[model samples]
Target chain A: MEQQIVKVKNKRGVRVIPGFGLSMGITLAMLGTLVLIPLASIFISASQLSWEAFLDVVTSRQVVSGYVVSLSCAFFAALVNAVFGLMLAWVLVRYEFPGKRLMDGIIELPFALPTAVAGISLTYLYSDRGWIGALFAQAGIQIAYTRAGITIAMVFVGIPFVVRAVQPVLEKLDRQYEEAAEMLGAGRICTFFRVILPELFPALLAGFGLAFARGIGEYGSVVFIAGNIPNKTQIAPLLIMTKLEQYKYADATAIALVLLVISFLLMLFINSVQLYMQRFGRG
Target chain B: MAQKRQRTYQQDIVGDGILAVQKVREPHTEASGKGIRCGLIGICALFLFVMLVLPLAVVVINALRDGWAAYQEAVMDEYTVRALQLTLFTAVTAVAVNTVFGVFAAFLLSKFYFRGRQILAALIDIPFSISPVIAGLVFILTFGNVGWMGDFLKAHGIRIVFAVPGVVLATVFVTFPFVFRELFPVLNAQGKDEEEAAALMGAGWFTIFRKITFPHMKWALLYGVILCAARALGEFGAVSVISGHLRGKTNTLPLHVEILYNEFNTTAAFAVSSILVILAVLILIARTIVEWKKA
Candidate 1:
């Protein structure tokens, strides 16, 4: 019916697919109901408070610490995933070894594994009496119930994003430029630094941004491991839950507002970056 | 383009060089010669094993320590059994509902044309960026006491914030995107040519969908459904907030594990966690296979 009604366009057309008008309308409605309305309500509820009260709630010592821990851990974890996840992607794309399939499979373990279960497992494995924790404990290196534990959990959850994002780029990459560099007598390291890294830069940033976003809101995994030591190891998500549990509704909303705002801005920036990359990426 | 070309070139050289090295490296000192590739593979496996496998193995070992007796005891307990049943029931319902709604949304996004398309596309990712816990909070603020719709619903006694209904709602929120994300790309790549051809041959929408479209979407749909199921079963933060964690009422398996762990019943926690681990492993295996086939 569509083909019969609509004339065929030239190959170099404005759109990739037809029916853009209808699809976009339906997409708008779905997004409105599922996302926009609820998010709008969060901000509205947040606006109910006076500016001073909002400031007080967001600036409390515990709240400030929570923000610090959550943000710093998210940043560092994403950085770590960016660095190592690229390596993992490179290995998968460049090498053929036994258990290659297994490595690929395990890369996504964090996605299917329940955050709570992962947290419990991490706590069990890294607690003072647990296996690795015993070694860390003896060396005066804390893991579980500490900032380090939070970072570990964040990294675990965030690694998959980087790997998934970078893998396809590595696979689709053409081989001419690096060969030319090598043919020009460039060292292996120099060839990599000069010829390859720039192309991956956009993808790397996008992946890092995604990982950072994911790490911020992480709860189930971080909660158990962080020990929720208020003002110390407590992340913002936990702080929000704690506030709610304690019947501090106003404070809870305020803290949640802070997280929501930060996450919203962060995501907006990332989305723009991704859009920029997607545009430049094709060239 | 330069980067892509360079990356591939480097990779080919390195990969081929390593293979060549493996063949030519003498027997003596061969281990050191194969160090880079071998060490890289070994390190990746070790990281996966320590992080992904060990805790899961510990749970399984602990659960089976007393053999079938312990497994049976845990599974047969009234609270444990009830929680398990409710979790399964809710997960199934959530995934099914999300699948229908998700396919519609994906179909619309993939097939239609309209205004606000870019904005709408961005909104699908809201659930992804927002915490599940925060999603629950959003629902509560919209439907709970003092919520925007609370007064009208409370008058009708149609509670939605503190029962199984709320759990299902939260689960739906988290899992809604799974099917849509999976199906959108498939739909984009396949296009509507064949469906239009079927329509030209006098097929109805349902016929075209059932015979022409679903076949293409089947594997992706299955993949999405499985991922959604895994998430629904293991959902803790969102469901816990809205469900009130009412032991037999809202306590999911993950919550049950937490309760047991807090009670210091490590065995029970491990036992329940082991079940989830098995489910996760199955999902992981299925996802891996599907992805490999796609690749």
Candidate 2:
């Protein structure tokens, strides 16, 4: 019995802490029931549709337009976030100012606040009678119930991803690089563009990808602001809801399957990039 | 010696000239640097104000736009009250279940080297990337009338889709990764040497965890719980899909806000939203405290 136990240990390597079976059992059981099985149902339901029918559902004009609005709005929003998020992170990390901690704390507000609240509040704020919206109304640019409104909603939800992603990397950044660049006659703009930005690129890209992916998948915040105009401001997730509401289960599954596949690929890419970055150190 | 002395004298004068030039430029550069700093800070402040702070303020202002009496009436409405109760129940249940699963998964992944560990970690993160609407959709497809187990569930007299169980299930799915993600890094950093040492001394796994691992994980676990609970409390899209708009029966706070807003009961919607905003603030405060403690 002792020899058999030793052999088992030798083969699998030593695991001194007990409860492997118990922990693995509970983890897999919960993960399977709660996450995997339900996710698989999407695939199973989608598979029930023939390839041609699946293509037809996903490629239909309204659905195609939904994809366009979602992807474009998310793209622009993430782009905005990448720029502003870097600025916020830079301000938080490099400068000492009043209310810095408060600023830091509220960077997570979007994450903590309910999307429904954000949706209603944003819609109100940017509506024509509201303060900011009234200003834009005079400028002859409508925001609420438009593509711009949808983009703003996306930006709000995606803000935390980039800020949180880049903050740590920025904080850990070596100051010596800045000093060296300055000593080498690099001006402030040149130093930032050439020296600091390169180092922050990987983290910035990771944040951008996360924010973009999130913006694409965002629903509650955008739906109210999006105005749900078919073939115009309608987002992909909202279309799924529309299909579900109409009891078109197969159609909903097909759209969801497309989204799932895209998001999965994006996540896989981000994870691999992160893994590579960790191995190679900061770029 | 005289030639070297002459060269030293020239070098000293040249150095003095350079110093004088830099001294002349110092004030100007310093002023610009300060200006740049203030500009950057101002932009960040303005953006965050517009994006985050302003929307929060709007909720409060609009909620009170109808006067205190009206705000109170909306909040005290029977359906709103029921929705609040249901929201609390779902948040608590989801947090409790995820907390247990988080601990087990964290321990298993951090302590033991096993096959398919990477795949498991990735699988855990799937919920985070997937849309909440899809999360709800998957559940409906699994438990709705035409689902795979639909007939079996009907035979058993079980109703999950468009019911409270479906609501809870969707909440659980979306918040699944939060606790595990939070706990894993802390556990992995602490490593297994201490746990292994305790084990070799004839301590049981539970005892070792209580005396050793649990101490290190307490703050992270709390942080995770706060995040999970906050998310579970505010979840809208998933609950919205699964709840079937059965006001007073299935509406969570977020869904209640939606129903109110859509019905043009704008004041009522903002009032209920104020509750969630306050809860979010409280969670933010709790998260700040946990971060400080963890650090």
Candidate 3:
């Protein structure tokens, strides 16, 4: 037993900590219970219906429209957040103006604010006769109770993901690289384009993926602003809830299964990019 | 010599072409004096202010309206209070469980290298990407009376769906990654030297953990707890499906807000949502400070 322990230690490199196996077993068990088993059963329940039935449920007009709205808004919101969040993170990390720390703290407000509050607040801000909404109305721009409203709510929640993800990368990037470029007679814009952006590209992509993923799955914030109009403003998650409430378990599971595939594929794509970046290291 | 050369080079630029020159030399100057950069910062400041601060200000203003007796009545009503309690209770329990499970998982993943460990590590993040609505449905399919485990749970009279336990379960699923995400990198970076030192000092595992590991993990754990709490309180997708929206029973604050909004009680919805918004803001501020401290 002692020799076996020594062999295990040799294989591990680090000395074997006591209880590691026990903890591993417990961890796997917990993950299986809370995550894997539950997720698998979604597919299982979904599979109970015939493939034709599954297709019909998932591809229903309202459900399809919900998907269109969710994916399009999430995509647009994530793109907007990436562009603007990068700029915001750049300002926070590279500048030393008054209220900088306060500004930094405010960047995470979306993460902390409950989605319901975020949704309602956005609605309040953009609803006709409301502060910003009245101004938009004067400009003939309708936001509240429309796709624009959904996108706005999504942007409100999604910005923090990009800012938080990109901030550290920006902060840790050696200023020496950009400074060296400046010393080589490269202009500021050229230096940013050539030196700074390339290094930040992978992190920015990761942030975009995260923000997009969150937006796709988002329900709480969008529902208030969406007006929950079927075949129009309704989101995919809300559709799933509708099916469930209607006691169509198989239908709900099938719709969920479709969403699962899309979200999983998108996340997998992002993860692959992240892995490539890790392997290549800040190129 | 490099510093002197760089400064003089910047000065030479100031003498050469003002616009391009100032832009090139901007990095060496006091950050405040960077003209276009300051304008860029101003734009960023405005965006964050309008998106985050203004929405929150509206919530607070609505919450603090002293003479809005109807709104106050809505916020403090029996249904409202019960919903808030349910929300808090479920969130606290879920976060407490998540912390324990997340720490153990993080420790196992960080301290030990095993086959499939990387796979397990990646799998923890699925909940983050997985639609919460899907997550909620899975729970229903797993623990609802007709679900796989539902029969067993029903036999034992242990209700999982449409109850507080259902809310806790879904909250756990959604917030599961926070503690692990926070701690895993910290543990991996810090390594096990202090733990080893404690072990060599004749400290048992529990003693070593309590004295050594816990101190390092406390702040991360607290941050994770706050995040989990915020997620739990705000989670609408999963909780709404599982809660069945029993007015004074299973309804959480988020669900309450939804229900009130559906009822067209806009003022009440804002009032209830504002309290959660304040909690979220406080938690975010705390997380930012802790993160800044770590930096």
lDDT of every predicted structure (CA atoms):
0.79, 0.90, 0.83
Q: Give one digit per residue, the lDDT tens place, for model 3 in B1-295.
A: 8788576666655643555555566656745447878798889988988888889888877666655786678778999999989988988888888888888888888777778988998899889997778878889999996588988997899988998889889989998888899888878887876776566567776776677777888778777877787788788888888889989989999899888878977778888987787678778777877777665
| Cα error, candidate 2, residue A216 (Å) | 0.9
Q: Write the per-residue lDDT of candidate 1 for residues B1-295, one digit (tens) a residue.
A: 8888778767766664556544333322445436766776677777677777777776777777777888878867788888888888988988887787667777766655556656666677678887777878877777878577889999998988888888888887877687788888898788877866776677766776778778888888888888888888888888877888789887888889888888988877878887788889998988878776665
Ranking by DockQ: 3, 2, 1
TM-score comparison, 1 vs 2, better candidate: 2
Native contacts recovered by model 3? 0.68
Compared with the true structure, model 2 gives a TM-score of 0.93
Candidate 2 clashing pairs, residues 3+ apart or interchain: none
DockQ of each: 0.41, 0.50, 0.52
Off by over 4 Å in 1: A1-34, A277-283, B1-34, B65-68, B196-203, B292-295
lDDT of 2 by residue, A1-283 (tens): 5436755769865777888999999999999999999888888888789999999999999999998998999999999999999999999998999999999999999989999999999999999988788999999988999999999999999999999989999999998887766554555665676789878878998898889998989999999988888799999999999999999999999999999888888878877887786778644
Question: What shift in Å separates residue A6 of candidate 1 from its native position after superposition?
Answer: 5.1
> If both were scored by DockQ, which would come out higher, candidate 1 or candidate 3?
3
Q: How high is each candidate's TM-score?
A: 0.88, 0.93, 0.91
State the local distance difference test value for candidate 1.
0.79
* Model 1 Cα lDDT, one tens digit per residue, A238-267: 888887777666787888887877888998
List ranges where model 2 is wrong by over 4 Å: A1-13, A276-283, B1-29
Q: Who is ahead in lDDT, 2 or 3?
A: 2
